[model samples]
Target chain A: MRDFDLLQPQHLSDALDALAQNDSAIRPLAGGTDMLVDIRAQRAKPDVLVSLQNISELRGITRENGTLKIGAATTIAEFLKHPELTKHDALRYAAYVFANPMIRNSATIGGNIGSASPAGDMLPPLLALDAHIELVSKNEARVMPLSDFFLGPRKTAKRANELITSIQLPVISYQSPVSSLQSPVSSAFYKLGLRQADAISLISVAVWIQRDGEKIRDVRIALGAVAPRPMRAIRAEEILRGEIFNEMNLKESARIASEECSPIDDLRASANYRRRMIAVYVRRMLEQAWSKTQ
Target chain B: MQKKTILFSLNGEPREWSVYPNELLLNVLREQEFLTGTKYGCGIGECGACTVHINGEPILSCLTLAIACEGKEILTIEGLAREGKLDPVQIAFLDQTAFQCGFCTPDMILMTRALLNEIPNPTEEQVRDYLRGNLCRCTGYASIMRAALDASVLNAHRSVQSNEE
Candidate 1:
């Protein structure tokens, strides 16, 4: 890694001040799992590294106003251990199979989302949950929908001096108790990686469905690694919304999900292979989601 | 470049060191502190050869910045044995012949210690999951898995025995 000035801020405000002072020349360091790897591989280099480990405001999970707020610096281990996240199968599955135990202990959700990788395990499920990010800077703070946060591969809408403070996700039925007349959330996430452990996803799918008995009232399907950025399969979702889970709808939605993606051929998988796997995985995830509703 | 000297507890001893911002904890342990038990398998975080305990959690030292070690307690493989007595995991590994080349032993032992510290009795799947990050090309994972299970029982026995002392 290239040598750079290290700024250790004792507070979140101080960290923001350091970022504002250094602008694009500085990068915020959270768990350093992704950032350190990028720096070592020479994929990223900055004049200063601002450490956020000491920032208390950026470190825990909370629920307020019917939303789940996860601090940007909360490690993947911490998030997975949270009682709320564990009960949500989609999030738990993603957390369980993400990277490995050691990496999970050191990688943060904020860094995962902040890195803006299409293959990020946490993004698709979070996107399926309709999560939004909270970005803070010295001057102002703003919240952006998670779907709109990513601009491209390794790119985001966040400004240079901005620090991601928290990720707020809607408290869906899966995260709360099922009340009378309230349709329980049925969600599932599937990742197609080369190997079971320590492999990046070639293609991944997540589905969030709220069914009124056998009819799907609402559904959100999110796909990852099949696009430059993780995206919702809007066309596929539209076909399944207000429709019953059947062989025909499942096949059509799966086809639409595959067709709507924009994947590229990489060493891990060919673009054609990813598209096919996307269809298969989408069908599988939808089946899993439907089974949960029963 | 801005440099800072930070104080942190290492293996139960307080130490102060001046380090560069980009210096990784793996390099600092091996070079500055001369603690080479933490191996460097891959410079990136993929390989867990540099696994160490930071505040009772297993993390990749290669990915952790040395300057970030301020005020935190770090435990390396060298810290496992105390007063010439081997850790239970080490004893179990020896009895079960868990390693062959021994290249990944330090990381394996430390990872098991961390696991047993949290879960005294782990299921086979849990043991495999926790040790998955520490790759051992020599043992084929069978003996390692056996050793991990035995270590849990050995550790539990040792704990009960110690509590009575």
Candidate 2:
């Protein structure tokens, strides 16, 4: 760690003001987990570090009108404990399996989103749930859908002067009595890694299904770590909507899902292996999602 | 970089200090307070050696900025014992032979304490899930799990005896 100017803003306004002042060289740090790792690797060298830890407003979990708002500075550890998120069983399970306890406690939703890595553990769940993000600057604030947030791997629509305030997620009602085949939503997200606990996903998928009896409704599937960004398999999703929910439908969906991805094989796995895993995960996750409704 | 002075309670006593802008809580503990009990085996967050209780939650000190300590209470491994008496988790670790090289003991003890705090009577699998972050290099995890279970049993026994009286 080189000698750097640390700015600990006591309030949200102050933090944004500081960012405005040091717009060129300042990087907002909610938790040093990602920033420090990047700094040590010499990948990032910000002359001024904008520390958001002291900004109390940035740490909380709240819900209003069936919308869940998670503060950007809130740690993943904190996110895992939120009763609202836990109620969303699939998202909570993904959060639990993300990384070690230490990383969870020290890493932030903002940082994870900031990294914009295709392998970001929380993004798929948020994307599948149709989450919205709020970004702030010294003089302005804007909210955008998660789909519009990412530009590429490690890139986003955010300007240098801006900072993420919180992420808001629309809550889905799962308590209503509905037939498994006719439920409004049947969805699941799966990540395949080398082992289980902490390894990065070689491939992953997020599938949300709408059902009308044995006939499928609008279906959305998102895959991650296979492209520059986590991508919605729109073609595959198109292939499934209004289709019959059966083994044949699942097989067709899986094939479309595999071919829809633009995965490149690195040392972690080969492109061919990723395509196969994508198909396997698509079927497995979709079945599990349907089973939950049943 | 600019600097700030923070005052917070450490263990049971209040302490005030100033830290450099880039100083992490782990470095401050190791260098300033001379609390080597909190090991810094991995600068990265993967290892649990730098684990500490930040306001009762286990957070990696290495990844936490020292400036964040402005008003929060911190409990390191040294704070576990009170009045020179070993905490039950600490005693259980030794009784169940939970360490080989003794390097990961502090982190293991603290994590076990945190786990028991949340789930007073944790099952084997629950214990393992929480301990996934705390890796013991000497491969002393079997006894560590045994020790956590033993601590739970000891608490049950103590409660039963007290109830009988």
Candidate 3:
């Protein structure tokens, strides 16, 4: 690694002040699972490194005000271990999507969201759960819905001085003891990769739904690696909302969702393969989620 | 260079040291502590060859900064045994011949330890998923699975025996 000035601020205020002092030349550090890799690979080099390790507000998981507020620096392990997320629909789904134990224990959901990789495993779930991000700076702080946070692949609405503070996810605590989803909604996250582990997705989908009798009440569908950023299948979801559960309709919706993706042909997979796989995943996820509702 | 003094617990001991802001925690373990069990396969986070348990959860040491772990409990493969006694998992691995080339052995063992810590008795599918992070180019993980399950059974037997006694 190239020599760089490292600054560790004992408090959030100090961290922000350092960021304010070196606004353009500073890059804040989180879990560094992603950032360190980028730096070592020569992707990014800032003159000042503001380590967020000592920032107290950037850690922990809490359930308050009917929302699960997860600190930005909270590791994926923290999110998975969070008592509330496992109960909700999308978050529970996202919690199980990532399989690598090391990544789960170290990679922060904020860094994942901040990195804005189209293949970010948590984005789909956060988008589905209607989560919002708190981006804080020395002078100001702003909140953005997870959906609007992403600009494109590897891009976000984050300013130079801004640092993500926490992600607040609205908890879906509604439970029907006499219903199929009594045991936290059954979720299926399918990411097609060359190997079962350590392989980035060629295409991935996260689907979460609430079943009302024979009809689906709230259906969320998000796909990654098939678009520039993790994107919601809005039209597809719209098609399923308030619609009676049917395999045929689900398959058709899958096709429509596949049609929406602008996948690129790369060495990992062909664009055609990704689109077709997206359809397959939509079908698989719906079938799995629908079966759980049953 | 970005250098700072850090205080952290290592293998159940507390100490302080100076580390580069950019230095990976794995490097500190290898260079400072001389704990060579934590191997480095990939500098990036793609490979799980440099995984360690930070505060009871398996994390990639290579991706972790030395300064970030100032006050966290870390468990490397070296800390598995107590007072020279092999941990049940280690015994099971040795008994079942879990490794071949052994490059991935330490990571696999630590990963298994972490998995068993959470899921004491994991099914084959769960084991596969839980051990998904660590890679083994040799042996295809057949014996590794056997060893992990065998260790669980052994631990269960010991627990039951202790209760009975």
Candidate 4:
């Protein structure tokens, strides 16, 4: 890696100041699992690195008002250990299959989102959860839906001078008017990689659903590694939102999801294969999530 | 970039070292500190040859900047043994002949120690999952698995003996 000045900031405001410097080459250093690899490969070169490792503000997981507030610097290992995450299968499963134990110890949630890779393991699950990211600058702070954050592969809506502070996931609950009936809300994630560990996804899917009797009260499906960015199957979700949860509708929604994605032929997998697997995994994930609601 | 002095605990020893901003912890340990047991296989963090414990958790040293070690406790393979006696995990690896090329042994041992620390009696599936990142290119995983199980028993025996004492 090329030599660069390292600025270790103890406070979030100081880190923001360092990033808001006149030079656009200044980059915020989070876990360094992704950025360091990119730098060694010459894919990213920054003249200055603002280390956020010492910032206590960006390292925690908390819940308030039925929303999970995850500090941007929280590592994947932390997610695996957190008690609250176990209730959300999609996010926890994504955390479970993310790289390996060694990488998870150092890879932070913010870095995963900041890198903005289409195959990032956390993106599809977060999209399914309807996560909102909080970005902070020296002068201002803003919140935006994760769906609007990614523009393309390794691209995001974050400004050069801003830093992602935390990710907020709303704790969605479904209630039945009749006390005797049961309402279930569940989410599931699946990743197809070449190997069991440390392999990037060929295609991945996440599904979140609320079951109201025989009909789907609400649903969201997210796909990864099959587009320029991790994306939602909006049309397929629209079809299933109020429809009966049945095999025919599930197959139709999965087919629509496969058609919605625009994947390219990559070294790991062909575009045709990815589209086919997308249909299979989408259907499987939807089934898995729906089964949990039962 | 100017060189900066960092203070951290290495192998239970307090040390201060000067490093450039971009210098990786793997290089500093191998070159400056002369603790070369940590091998460099894939500098991109894919290979676990450079694994070390930062604050008791195993992490990739090649991808970690040396400056980041300031005020942190780092445990490398050189630190795994106490006073020239091998750790239980190390003894198990030697007894089981867990490696062939031995290029990935240091990281494998470190990761095994970390896993055993977390799960004293981990199942075979758990052991495989935990050590999945530490790849043995010689494909000597069967022996490695045996060594991990043996180490768990050895660790338990040692703990029981120490408790009796």
CA lDDT of each candidate? 0.88, 0.83, 0.81, 0.93
Name the lDDT of candidate 2: 0.83
Q: Which stretches of candidate 3 lie over 4 Å from their true place?
A: A21-24, A63-66, A172-188, A210-213, B157-165
Q: What is the overall TM-score of model 2 with all chains considered together?
A: 0.93
How many collisions per candidate? 0, 2, 0, 0
For residues B96-118, what per-residue lDDT tens digits would candidate 3 score against the true structure?
98988888888888888888889
DockQ of 1: 0.81
Count clashing residue pairs in model 1. Answer: 0
- A193-280, model 1: which lDDT tens digit per residue? 8987888999999988887777888999999998999999999999999998799999999999999999999899999999999899
Residue B12 shift from truth in candidate 1, angstroms:
1.2
Q: Write the per-residue lDDT of candidate 3 for residues A1-294, one digit (tens) a residue.
A: 866677778789888887776466688877777888888888887778888877787888887888788889887766566676565545655655575777877677888898899988888777766789999888898988888989898989988878899999776666666764464344556767887666788988878877887888878888888888999899888888889889878988899999988999999999999999999989888888778764
> Model 4 Cα displacement at B19 (Å)?
1.1
lDDT string for model 4 (A1-294, tens) is 798899998999899888876466999999999999888888888999999999999988898998899999999998788897777899999999999898898899999999999999999999999999999998899999999999999999999999999999998555656652454888999999998888999999999998878899999999999999999999889889999999999999999999999999989999999999999999999999998775
In the predicted model 2, the residue pairs found to clash are A4-B1, A5-B1
True contacts kept of 1: 0.84
**Any idea what lDDT model 4 has?**
0.93
DockQ of each: 0.81, 0.71, 0.66, 0.88
- TM for every model, in the order presented, reads 0.96, 0.93, 0.90, 0.97
For TM-score, candidate 1 versus 4, the one ahead is 4
